[model samples]
Target: MSISVVILAAGQGTRMKSTTPKVLHEISGKSMLFHAIDAAKKISDDITVVLYHQAARIQESIEAHYSGIHFHMQDAVQFPGTGGAMKGVHVTHSKALILNGDMPLVTMNALESLMQGDADINMSVIKLDNPSGYGRVVISEGSVVEIVEEKDCKPEQKEIQTVNAGVYCVKKELLESYIPALSNDNAQKEYYLTDIIKMAVDEGKPVHPVIVEEEEFKGVNSKLDLAHAEEILQRRIKTEWMKAGVSMRLPETIYIDSRATFEGECMLENGVSIQGASHIIASHIKTHSVIEDAYIQNSDVGPMGRIRPNTKLINTHIGNFVEVKKSTLTGVKAGHLAYIGDATVEEGSNIGAGVITCNYDGKNKYQTNIGKNVFVGSDTQLVAPVTIEDDVIIAAGSTINKNVAQGELAISRAPMKTIKGFFYKFFGEK
Candidate 1:
C-alpha cells in the first residue's frame, strides 16, 4: 500500500498573536513547515500541502524549497475547518498520514510507526498526568470508543490518562465517507478533526489508538511554547553531538544554529560560539582564542589567529596574532600587533606594537594604505588617506598624513625646547 502524506496547514494560529503564518515562523532559521514536510518526505514521496491563509506567499515559499509536493487550496465556503481542509485533498486511494504544521519536533520514527499501524483509523494518543484542558480518550475493549473534549467530558471521564494528540493515520475511504456527516456541534461551533473519532465508533468501525510519547505530540500555539520547543530540540542536538566525538564546555550555554557543522575532536570552549553557515575542518585551536559572538561565513580561522571576540568576518583571511573587530579585514594582514580598521595593510607587513592606522578623520572614514615591508613604528598614528610606499619607516610617535616615498623615514613631532632654569626662576626665594 502506498503511504501518502497530507499536511494540514490552513490554520492562522491566532493564539501566536502575529500576522506571519504560524508555520512560516522560523526555528533555527528554517521555517517550521519545512521541517514537517522534510519529515514526511522520508516515508512517502507523494505529499500534499493544504493552504488557505496567506495562501499565495506560503505556496511561493514551498515552491522555492521543494519542487514536487502537491498543493491543495482550501475553499473558503466548501472547506471551513481543518477536517474540511483534509477532505479537500484528493489523494489517490492511499493510506493517509495527517500531520499538523505547528509541531516541528515530531520525529520521523514516530510518524513511520503511525503510518505502519494501518488501522481503519488510528489516533496518535499520549498519556497526560493532568488531562484537564485536553481531550480525554475513552477506550473500550482495547479500541478507542470516543475522544471527548475537556469542556464536554464528564467528571469521571476527565480522570482518563490517554488524550487525543490531534495526529492521525486513516484509510482514505473511511475518512471521505464520514467527513460529510461532520457537524459544528461543539462549544466553539467549529468542526473539530477529533469529531471523526466519535463518528467512527458510532458506525462500529475499528478505531485504534497508538500511544506516542508526550514530546512527540507537543504543538506550538504561543511564543512561549515555541521557545520551550526550541530548547528541547537544542538539548537533543547537543546530546547527539556529545555522543559523537566532539567535546563541548558547558553545552547548555552554547547557542549553535542547527545548520552549523563541526568536525570531530574540535573543542568548543566556554563562550565560544560559531554562527551563520560557518564550517570548520580538522583544525586545532590554542587556548583563549575567543571567537566570541562572531558571524563567520565561508572563512577558515587559523589555529593561532586571535579573532578577538565580537567581530564579523565574511569572505576574509586572518593570520596569527591579529586582533580584528568592529571593522572589515578582507585580503589584509598584520603579521604582528596592529589595529587595522578603516585601513588596508598590504601583504607581508610587520606592524609593531602601538601601531594605530588612524582611519577616522573626525568627519568620515578614510583608507590608509601601507605598502609591503613598511615598518610602522611604535605609537605612530598614520592619519588616513595617506599612503606609505614600499620600504618606508615611520618614526615612533609620529603622525604621518602625507605619503612617504620608498626608503624614507617620515616623522611628525613638535620641535624640542630646553627649560633648564624654569623651576628655579619661578621659586627663587626657596
Candidate 2:
C-alpha cells in the first residue's frame, strides 16, 4: 500500500514568543520539523508538509538536507488550523500518516507500532500526569469513543489523563471526507483535526488507539518544552556514543552532533562539543574543546582547542587555546596559543606558543607551507604566501614574510646593541 505522511507545521506558536518559527527551532543539530521528517521518511517517501508562518524561510533552510520533501502552504483565509491544514495539503495515497512538526521526540518505532495496528484508523495517545490544555481521549470498554478538546470537555472528561498525541494513521479518503464536516465552533475558532474522532465513531469504523510513551510524544510549544526535548535528544546521543566505545569524563556535559562519526576508543572530557560532520578515531578530546566539520585521527586535542571547518589532523597535538581552520597537519606539535589557517604543516614540525599563520592579507587569503623537521619559535608570525623548507628554524619573536630554504635559520629581529648610558639618557632614571 502507498503511504503518504502529512506533517502539520502551520501553527504560529505564539507561546514560544520568538520571531523565529517554532518548527525551525533546533534540537541537537537539526530542526524539529526535520526530526519529524527524518522519522517519517523511514516509513514513506511520499511526505507532504502543510506550512505557514515563515514557510519560505523554513523550506529554503531544510531543503539543503531534505530537498525531496514536498511542501504545501496553508491558506490563512480559507484553511486556518490543524483540521484546515490537513484539508489544505495534498496527499498522494489513500492512507496517510499525520504528524505534528513540533514533536521531535516521536520515534520511528512508535510510528511503526501505530501502523501495525489493524484498523481503519489508528490514533496515537499518551498517558500524561497533567494532561490539561490537550484533547482528552474518551475510551469506552476497550474501544476509543471520542476525543474532547480541553475547552469543550465536561468536568469528568477534564480529569482524563490519556490525551490525543496529535499523531495519526488514517485513510486519506476518510479524513478528507470529514474535512468539510469540521466545525469552527470551538473556543479558538479553528477547525481541529481532533473532531474526526467523533466522525469515525459515528461511522462505526474500527478506531484503534496506540498508546505511546509520554516522552516519545512530548511536543515543544515553548522554551521550557524545547529544553526538555533537547535534554532527551542529548541523552540519547551521549548514550549511543558511549555504547559504541566513546568514553567521557562528564558524559552529561558533552554534546555530540548526530552527523558525527567515530570509531575505536576515544576520550571526551567535560564541555566538549563535536558538531557538524566531525570524524574522530582513537583520539583524546580534552575539556572545553569545540570541533566542527573537521577530521582527526590518532591525536590529542585540547583542554581548550577550537577546530574549525575543513581541517585535518593526523598524529597531531593541538593543545590549549589553539585554533585551526582550513589546514592540514601531519605529525605537527602545536602546543599552545596559536592560530593556524589555510596552511599545511608536514611531519616532525614544532609550532611554538603564540605563533600565528597570517593567512589573510586584507583582500586575499594565502597558504603557509612548512616542510619536515621545521622549528617555529615562540611569538613568531608566518606571514602567508611563505614557505619554510625542511630543517628550517624560525627564531623567536620574528615575523617571517619570505620563504626560507632547507637547513636555514631565519630571523627578522633587529640587531642587539649595548648602550650603557642610553637608558639613563632616554629615561633619565627609571
TM-score of candidate 1 versus the correct structure, residues matched by position: 0.73
Candidate 1: tens digits of C-alpha lDDT, residues 1-430 = 3788888888888988999899898775468888889888888888899999998989999999898889998774665787678665777646788888888888889897787655788888899887778878898898999877788888798889999887888888877887777777756566567778878888888889888988866888889888988888778777876687667777777555566666646565544444445444343333334453344544445434555434555445554455654444433434445566655555445566667777776888787777767777777887888888878888878988799998998888898899998988998857
Residue lDDT tens for model 2, 1-430: 3688889888899999999999999898888988999999998879888888888988887787876789988875676778888765668887889999999988889888888756878998888889988888998876789987798999999999988877889987787788778888867788878778788899998788888988888889999999989999999888988999999998989999877989899999999999989999999999999999999999999989999999999999999999999999999999999999999999999999999999998999999999999999999999999999999999999999999999999999998989789979998986
TM-score of each: 0.73, 0.95
- Scored by lDDT, model 2 comes in at 0.90
Candidate with the greatest TM-score versus the true structure: 2
Distance from true location, Cα of 308 in model 2, Å:
0.9
Question: Which stretches of model 1 miss by more than 4 angstroms?
Answer: 283-430
